[model samples]
Target: MIFAMVNVLAPIFAITLIGFVLGRSKIELHAGTLSTTVLLVATPALIFSSLTSYGVTPTMLLEMAAAAILCLSASAVLSMLTIKMFGLSMRSFLPSLMLPNSGNMGLPLVMLAFGDEGLKLGVSYFFFVALVQHSVGFSIASGSYSMSHLLKQPLIYAVAAVILVSTTGIAVPEVVLTTTEILGGMMVPAMLILLGSSLAGLTISDLRPALVVAVSRLVIGVLSALAVIWVLGLEGRVAGVVFLLSTMPTAIITYVFAQRYRPEPGQIASAVVASTLLTFGCLPFLLWFAVKVLEQS
Candidate 1:
């Protein structure tokens, strides 16, 4: 388990660290362009390839979709409560509270911890989260919901294609699959590098808000997963996937939206950095705990 964990996490952290160093060195790499490449090209291909090859069952897909919806709903409610409690304005509240970085960080962690089965679940969860994020999540992050923004997400297109192929029982051509694989393969390393570059800009002032977001994500996400597991009787790897994904740090997209629209870009950026750093410690411990619980059951 430890070996598996290290194998999965090492590359992610390593590439991210490299990106961080490059950015700090005053390199000319454009963060926005790099991020756009990942989101628009690499990640979509990865998502399409993973979903097409996974051979997910209808029941499993339904369960995962349900779980994703449940988890995000809980997060949304909690975020609203937090915003109210803190008395933050609408401009700042959405970015700080609505988004979690479930893709770059959460998905990789899931694949590491649970392998292909977990990857399938992560893909479904990613879709649901992306859907909600674009709709409600966008509204929160941008202070107003826009249907156009929701329609434009790359993951949405990928999910639609995956579902279409899945329902039709059509196989992707080898040539096409190979091409996507090559592009998709670039996702993790590229994302990690971007993460590192983003982190290179972090400062001491970023720590406090980051701590707040980290604690909020950990406490609320974990408790929500536990409640769902208890109420719904989810077990084995599914339970594990739910718990880990719930605890993922605030996503970089949150920061992007904040920078574009929210009044608290600095605070949101701090949250993303803080939550991501904390996940390194929190994820392993959570995995061990979930496994132990599943064993006893």
Candidate 2:
């Protein structure tokens, strides 16, 4: 079990470490461009191709999406309670508490742990996650919602294309599929590198608040995920993806949003790095428990 878990995680962390090394060095990477490319092209392509190729049905997509919403909502509520108790800024902490690093970390873990089927579910879950981040999460940070911005998001088009292709039962051309597959293939490595690079530059000036938030986020994530899994009665690869993704660390986007729309970006930056580092300690056990226990849920 340990060996298999190591095999699954080693490459993911190693790639992240490479990105971290690059981040620490004198090299300059235009992260904004890379991030834009991933959001505009690679990720949507990945989502469309993976869902279509895997023959994931609308029913499955809906179930995964619903699970994601529930998990996100649970995290939000738990985070709110914690935030109130601790007197943390709702504008600053809620977004981090609610949005997990489902892209860079969660997707790769599920794909490696459970293979193609896992990727199918992970991508679907991540699609909705991105949607929420743009909509509800952005609202939390900015204190206002913009319908126009949400409509203009590339992911919305991706989801629409997925629905069109899925519901119409029309076969996509092999050339198009191949192109998308090639483009989509870079999402994981790009995201991991971006994650590592982001982490490399962030320093935790104060550890206590960051630790408090990180541990609370992880705990809320696990409990919320387990509750959702038990309530939904998910099993096998579906259950595994849901559990793994729900337990992910605070997303780096949290820091980005904080920087843009709120004060104390440093607090969020600290929490983001601390939470991600802390999740590594939990990954092995999460892998084991999902494989052994939750697979039968």
Candidate closest to the true structure, highest TM-score: 2
Clashes of 1: 4
- lDDT of candidate 1? 0.74
- Per-residue alpha-carbon lDDT of model 2 for 1-297, expressed as tens digits? 889999999988999998899899999977888988999999999998998898978998899998999999999999999999888899889999889999999999999999888899999999999999999998999999999978978888987888999999989999989999999999999999999899999999768779978999899989989899889988777888999999999999989888999878999999998999999888999889877777765
Query: Which candidate leads the pack in lDDT?
Result: 2
TM-score of model 2 (CA atoms): 0.98
* Candidate 1 segments whose C-alpha is farther than 4 A from its true place: 1-4, 204-208, 295-297
lDDT tens digits, residue span 126-207, model 1: 7777677667766866667688877888888887788788888887899988888789878767877887888888653556
lDDT of 2 at 146: 96
For residue 58, model 2's alpha carbon misses the true position, in angstroms, by: 0.6
